[model samples]
Target chain A: MRNIKLIIEYDGTRYFGWQKQPELRTIQEEIENAIKKITKEDVKLIGSGRTDRGVHARGQVANFHTNSRIPADKFKFALNSVLPFDISIKESTQVDESFHARYSAKGKQYRYLVYNSKTRSPLLRDYSYHVPYTLDLYKIREGAKFFIGTYDFRAFMSSKSCVEDTIRTIYNLEIIENGDLIELKVKGNGFLYNMVRIIVGTLIEVGCGKKKIQDIPKIIESKDRNEAGHTAQPQGLYLDKVFY
Target chain B: MRNIKLIIEYDGTRYFGWQKQPELRTIQEEIENAIKKITKEDVKLIGSGRTDRGVHARGQVANFHTNSRIPADKFKFALNSVLPFDISIKESTQVDESFHARYSAKGKQYRYLVYNSKTRSPLLRDYSYHVPYTLDLYKIREGAKFFIGTYDFRAFMSSKSCVEDTIRTIYNLEIIENGDLIELKVKGNGFLYNMVRIIVGTLIEVGCGKKKIQDIPKIIESKDRNEAGHTAQPQGLYLDKVFY
Candidate 1:
């Protein structure tokens, strides 16, 4: 059997998410069905992580085992020919037997777009969160510094998630502003469910003077779900890259 | 009656062009319906120009005369409250009584996006033209210069157009290359039907070695539509700005 690694990109506007459900359309199920059509075998695809519905991905990584004689690089062309226009295979290569898509991943990077303008932009409606109020970037930047180190990020996660190991390390967080668009790029070793969105939501509160710049540490230390701000919309989030 | 001017933006993916047809969904018709809902008057809207199906606009200008008592700037907020998410009124103001959207325009600027890569991008599928061939930027730049002056651009237009005065003045043409995306920004006093698309297609042929760099002037002098390359797809074209 060959262990095939794939890098994929997708527009998640119409998808339920990266995971497969019985009746809903998903990215993983579509690719797995395509693989079955090409290889004539049932293969379980392991994704690096899960993205909520309407969340996009630029470099999602996945791996699956197959008993086919097709060349690794040619799988991209074959898969892309069958996949829908909203999904594309960027690369496909063979890996060693021990390679695992989820376990072997070291870190991940996420990008969020915020459209901070008085008037909503039709072109950016599907890909960005529209915030029609004045924001204090200085306050937002100051508050973001608290999320750069290792800590218990239980408050930043969704209350529905019950993962026991809530300690994670964040390497870097950057806030970039261009015209009416504010972009947030974050890199971390691992993330809890809804972690990045909650962080962005907290920063937005700080920017709008709803929360104090000095309160981020307290919110993280509390480890209480109610201590954090609301979760940002899923459409503005993108799974940018996964490190192996 | 008050003459009102509006600067609008739209994501034209679902629209059947800017003009109104009896049974088709168009930007003009949608805006006209929204206007009637607010002012309860049947008024005619004059657009700066017509954008073909699937083409977008960032700063399309239009004007109309109305007997409503709504303030000029307040119309933007009122119209946006009732309009669909795919169209937006960026600005609205009262203009001089003699102002006409189509007749008073002096020049226009357009932008085109070309995605040049081995793999198709799912994120840019609706807004960019995908070209899987390697292009030489130097050759494209050289070929674009021939279009920077006044000329009879009959060959660059669609064969169905019957405009007698085929002469137009091009102020500037720029080709910007960034990674796998090539951007073309052109400003001109006027353009014939399908002129920009044909020009882009011809320049692409030159970049890919399908057409020679030295044959641009002769192609223009021929004044034959077949002498030029194919018309580029409408999805990659954007009406960027309108000058008055």
Candidate 2:
């Protein structure tokens, strides 16, 4: 048996997510259907993690075992023909029998885009969130420094999260300004449920002058969900990449 | 009454089209709904032209009359609040009473994007057409020469189009290659129904080396629908800009 790994990309606007649930159109189900049609195997694909509905991914990874004769890299070309235009397998490679897509992941990177302007953008509306208010870029940068170390982020975890460990190492957190768009990029060893989003929301509050740059430390120290800023909307967040 | 002109942009994937059709979600209908909510007016906002379903726009223009107390430019913010996320008024200004969105335009630009790769792109699936084969770029340039100058493009018009005069001037026809993407940008005084799409189809045929490049003049002179290429899909086309 050979394990195949896939680097996938998708527009999550029309999908339920990466899991297969009855009555819900998910990326996983669509990919599985395509695979079944090509190989006639009812193989289950395991994804790196669960991305919420309407959250896009550029480099989502998945793996499944198959006894098919086709080359691993050729799966990208074969699967794309059967799948809808919204989902695509960008790259494929054969893996060792011991490799697991989920368990082998060392870290994950996420990016949240904010389209800051006096008016919302038309072409980018579906993909990014529109915030028409002025954001203080310097203040937001100062607040980002607080989230760059290992901490118990219990305050940022959501009630719906099943994560047992609230402590995680944040390798990097950056707020970059590019023309009219502001991108918040965060890389962590592991994230609590909604942790990245809550961090972004808190930073946004600081950007909007609602909170001082020093408030992020206090919010993290409190370990209360209410102490954090706000849970940022899901539409702006994207799972950029998962490192194995 | 103040006549306000708008430079608009939208991702038309969710819209029926630019015009308001009964029981269908149209761009015009959404903008009109937002206008009615703000000014209590049931005015028709006239667009420069109709874009078929799944078409996008960057600088499509529209004009409407209103007696609202808000300034013209501020309408961008006001209307965007109630309008769908995919539609945006990029720029708004008060125009002379004699100005009209459709009639005042001297020329308009349209662009169609194609991804020429063996593996389809997951990020731009909805935004571009995938042609997973190698094509000769020089041949396409020869065929596009026939589209320059002027022609009565009756053969290229769709059967569904309702128009009498098929004569239109083609100001410029350009085929540009950018990375993995090929962009077909055409500027014309006007276009007949599906004229740009048909031209694109013919150019793609030329690019694929299926049709001889120098045979373009005969194809146009033939004025037979069967002589031209297939109608390109609407999803890859966009109204790039409108010239006043």
What overall lDDT goes with each candidate model?
0.94, 0.89
Q: Residue A221 lDDT in model 1?
A: 96
| lDDT by residue (tens digit), candidate 1, B105-164 | 999999999999889998889898999999999999999999999999999999999899
Off by over 4 Å in 2: A21-25, A29-42, A68-85, A138-156, A159-179, A185-190, A214-227, B20-25, B29-42, B66-86, B90-92, B119-123, B135-195, B211-230
* Pairs clashing within candidate 2: none
Output the number of the DockQ-best candidate: 1
- Candidate 1, A96-192: lDDT as tens digits: 9998989999999999999998899998898989999999999988999999999999999999999999999999999999998999999999999
Report the interface RMSD that candidate 1 achieves against the true structure, in angstroms. 0.8
Best by the lDDT measure: 1
Candidate 1: C-alpha lDDT: 0.94
lDDT of 1 at A184: 96
> Can you tell me the CAPRI class of model 1?
high
Residues B13-119 of candidate 2: C-alpha lDDT, one tens digit per residue:
88898999999999999999999998998888999999989999988999999888789988988888888878988898999999999999999999999889777
Per-model chain B TM-scores are 0.98, 0.97
